[model samples]
Target: MTRPTALSVALSLSLPLAAHAAPDAAVVPDTTRDIDRVQVTATRTERAVSDVAATVDVIDREQMDRHLVQDLKDLVRYEPGLSVTSSATRFGLNGIRIRGLQGNRVRIQTDGIAMPTSFDIGAFSNANRNFTDLDTLKRVEIVRGPASSLYGSDALGGVVAFVTKDPADYLKDGKDSYVGLKFGYDGQWKGLLGGATGAFGGEHWSGLVNVNHRQGQETVNKGDVRVDNDRRTAPNPQDRDGRSVLAKLVYAPSDTQRFRLTAERNEDTTDTDVLSAISTAVPTPRAPLTSGMKAHDTQDRTRLSLAHEIDALDQPFADSLYWQVYTQNSQTRQQTDEKRTDGSRRHRVFSFDQRAYGLQAQLNKAFTTGSVDHALTYGFEGTRTEIRQKRDGYQVSSTGVVSTTVTPDAFPVRDFPITTTTELGLYAQDEMRLAGGKLSLVPGVRVDRYELKPDVDSIFAQDNPGLAVAQLKKTSVSPKLGMVWRFADQWSLFAGYAHGFRSPPYNDVNIGLTNVAFGYTAIANPDLKPETSDGYELGLRFIAPAAYVSLSGYYNDYKDFIESNVNTGRNAQGLIVFQSQNIADARIYGAEMKAGVEFGELSPALKGWALRSAVAWSRGDNRTDDEPLDSVDPLRGTLGLSYDADAWGVELAGTFVQRKKRLPPPAVQTNPNAPAASVYQPAGYGVLDLMAHWNFAPGATFNVGVFNLADKRYIEWSAITPGLITDRTLSDRFSSPGRTLSASLAVSW
Candidate 1:
């Protein structure tokens, strides 16, 4: 089959098909007709989404299948105001930026449990954002703005919530048991993926299980044609494997009460050259030389949770209640061996392990007084986190001479110490239905108490007494208020104001540093203040049987912004080190719009046709630094037209991005051989994508995608930043994947 040009594809809207979204193998899920039907996260209660005052975009299962994302970064491709920083290919430290904030500012929750973050030394990668498997997710929701009223800390920017699949979602009222299997492949990665799912039920009990595995595949990038061709070394090219398994059981002794137990495990491992880049172009007398860099990275996790729920029950003043207790453990280890070409040999090993346990309970009650009906919800959540970081190795001279002092075994070699973090939050929210259900008034408040403590080894204490001292504690109170006014049966106006806060993470406060080779020493800070944010948004929505539209704008003001590093300079070893501190303030603002129309409703002859579009624009100002925020995403827009038939469908989508001209000059250059301090700014571009599906038989389906149909090679701004580099290659940006084809097939009975 031949693909059309980007222009021709962009003009294919009149061709007719499933116009709402891409089809998965020949089927467009019927459930999508109920886009605004129901949601629980918005108000912590099961209610029609149209009644909520917040903006929540739910990526349903069908949509997930269409994207076929292999990692978390791919999930934001078609969405607006969401982008991931690609970092260098070597450490591959990538992160997602929502609106204008990322890192700790954005909270990642899996089934309501907070996930952990990852940070590495030499490679400079944040492996934290790539763990979750798409096969395990039933739906993903992006909630923009500070959600401190509901989730407390790590919610200054917003929240990304992941909900796993449930057997009940695929079961029928009379079905007792069912089994299914699926297999998929992508051209870019050249890999095979397979999974199995099963469910069985009885009068009082039911169970579900899903197991998925991706053997191994290396993601291929577009051919080299960027400003920086190959200045720095990239990670051992993409060889990796991953697996995920989940099991859930539900028991109901009566109609109104039930209990559920769920267990999940995920694992990923990679063995490749950690640092294979070498540049002899620079004058080498003062430069440290290396024979080669090789490493092995392995990350894994296991989680168990038990929950209880009660529906409209025989209670006094309460209507319902929900509670859960969960525990999770995860680890990331990297071992790299290096040989100096100059004659000296340097070897290193590092590991990060975290254990977390938490409890959550929520109570809901509905009552009416006079003209207003009230739905009140109260909840309390707590999490205790323990982290252990270890690093060991010996330094060597530039030449094959003598190996310097070996890394101490008894002393703490980690950037951070043995640490413990505990966070407790108590919150309550009330939804008032007034004016005969034409208006909703929501008021909520949350109180949070947090503490961080660390233990230092004698080796650390003897070298840095002030940095090895003790603990940090903080308390925060957050309030939220929102209102919605219904002017017409199908139109509503809403507005909200919320307060958010974030505390320093363990790594930033106490990354232990003792490098005698280069002569550098860093200490932990026991007294760091929290960062605070105030946000405001106003929006209008129009919903009807044939169409939907939403427009909104938001502004956020932050105080005492906690910058990860305030002072940067070379240590005794000549290695760069940073000390943490707070800045005066910062601000970000943005606007968003979404609209969809069903052409079938306008004309009978155009049945099964529709069109959809979404656009986002945002900007950030780091006032304290007097510069534009590099993390802020550029203006983006997506336009799509689709045709849906009973057993087949096709979709054509186009995404356009505006170039970013706002940027700060490069960092201050210190060492002569070190990378030149400069910024990686990207130019904007547009691309087109094509997808089609066919249901060949009863339970069989076929789907295909012509990615980058125009064969245009574009660069993602997030993927180019060097992220504190020691070498400068002058690469302006990271080029995305080139033209590729992808298809998948599945069957079940």
Candidate 2:
């Protein structure tokens, strides 16, 4: 027992929309710029990505379109320091892991509004990351380290903000209206998708709308094998469909003021036909066990927002200000129909709704006191969230038939109760210039207060004096500092320090229940401490007109890591379960480097040839328990070579992931006879990908890509690192898709 000191935890060149504001939804089709990609979230003000001291990555529209962006899951694969747990056949975004921390530790947002992070209740909670259409995004901004400096609370792991498209981005220069369309198909995913964007503008007003439709079949491993068993819960041949719409109206009343309103809706549904949706006839006394299952899962999300911005204020202290109000609502529903061993039908319906509303105001002022240039940004946010969940099952007749009338009180009570939470945040960042224009420093701080009050249903009481009780509230204040030194021409060094925190979630405190008759009980701990992390990073950047490169190293110290431990007790079900608790402290450290160079700039003989590469490696350990953090990302690298001509371009890309031996599986808490399954094995594999595209004209293009060119089958790290309790056997998990081909056509003007 010795604790390693804390610190924890890049891409590209020539990207269109490189200089777009972080929060101001990007507007563009395609155009390449030098090193001046502008971003606002880094400092709460407009600044190029090159000028920011902290690590920020921009996934431009060009890169996104090149990859045929599908969802958040698709976005994280190429980026370093981040991992998303979503399978190709999965319905919704599962979870995002950063710096070895998963779930609520990461913060997801669209524009400036916070998106709901995932939370599990009992053993039945579903993954929920509010929906967003990739077709509507201009770019994605990722802050790789602690972000509690600017955004409060859940910023412990980092931030992923989706920047959407706006009207001004699509309107033709000389025309009153503009329209764009895209269509694509992927054989691996069996996916067919189409999208359209239309915008119209007048002298002072602009309106835009984007619509997208997606449908797909389940992806499979080599030989088209469907790997569903009792443990994985996934049904082979899952069918999926998703539709999204985004509309916006923007008006500038005067040169100094502007107003905007936006409405967005996204809905997705997946259906699965299962052979064993329910457990079959068993040796136990409970006869007529469910033997087959079929389910339909659906998610619908809607957001309405209004914003007002003043470029310049009448008062001296308020140089510029912006404020907004927004409401977001989401619903997830699952319907399961099972056939019992005795040949009866059981219909189950489970649904949950989450509604959130918030108000935010930000103001910034710049002033000079002597030789130092100073800019200060201050903001406050207040948000309220309400959640309700209900579930019921009805019995049917013989031959696995139907039910027309409702069955009264046929199933168990609510699995999770109604809950409400209120969060308030205040933050400020000061960017000050020192040593003239050679050095810049940013000091920032944030305070967050979270209050939760749950109204548990009466189901908790077996007879009376149930385990329902109201408990704890938490608050945290974090401070951060960052500096950038432009010591040489086109070269700069940067370093930063930040404190991050995450308060205990509501469900963790209130989900206490027991079934004595069934032999299982899960008690909740109301007094849980918030998780905290100390992060430090140092890096360098070289920016030039024709090429760019960045290298960074980081370390992070984490305390009060949240985890649940299970005991050797049998419940009504044969398996053992656990409750949430603060188990241990951990540390993560790593280095990353990325570069893009166009050889034409240095040598004419290499004209039209460009090369890009990114490499990363990291390690983590549980300081208290003396074990390696299982989710640490292994050594990975990507290389690409491309040649661009007047009308056509071709590129060859390769990816390699090293086999990791770091974290061995700890003994399972359940029965030993069950045998160990997919532990932290982290099998390493590599594949080659190819892409070619033709630019038919300025506004039209056709692109084709072949993935997994070698047809090598491998399991991804994200899927199995976080093991599935739903698995009932000792077997392999889902494998990556096989060799697949896809082509897309995009047009804009």
Compute the lDDT of residue 610 as modeled in candidate 1.
83
Q: Write the per-residue lDDT of candidate 1 for residues 255-276, one digit (tens) a residue.
A: 7777889999998876665433
Q: What is the lDDT of residue 454 in candidate 1?
A: 85
lDDT of each: 0.71, 0.71
Ten contiguous residues minimizing lDDT sum, candidate 2? 7-16
Query: Please, what are the lDDT tens digits per residue for candidate 2 over residues 1-749?
Result: 12111100000000001112423324443435323566676677888888888777777777677666676756765666677765333343576777666666777788788876564332123647747777778877777877876787788888877778877767655667988899998776689999998889888898999999999976555433334334442336678899999999989888777788989999988887653233422624344555667778888889999988888796787788888899999888877776666667777667778899999999888999899999888888889998777655677766545553222222444544577889898988898998878999999999999888877656434321355556568889999999999999989999999999888776566654443333444556677788888999999999886789888999999888765433435545563434567767888999988788888888889888888788878899887778877777778888888887877788888888887678644434345686665444546899888888788988898888888899886666766534442242322435676788888898887
Q: RMSD, model 1, all Cα superposed? A: 8.4
- The TM-scores of all predictions, comma-separated, are 0.89, 0.89
Give candidate 1 regions above 4 Å deviation.
Answer: 1-28, 31-37, 91-93, 225-236, 274-276, 282-288, 394-412, 458-466, 514-520, 568-578, 671-678, 722-733
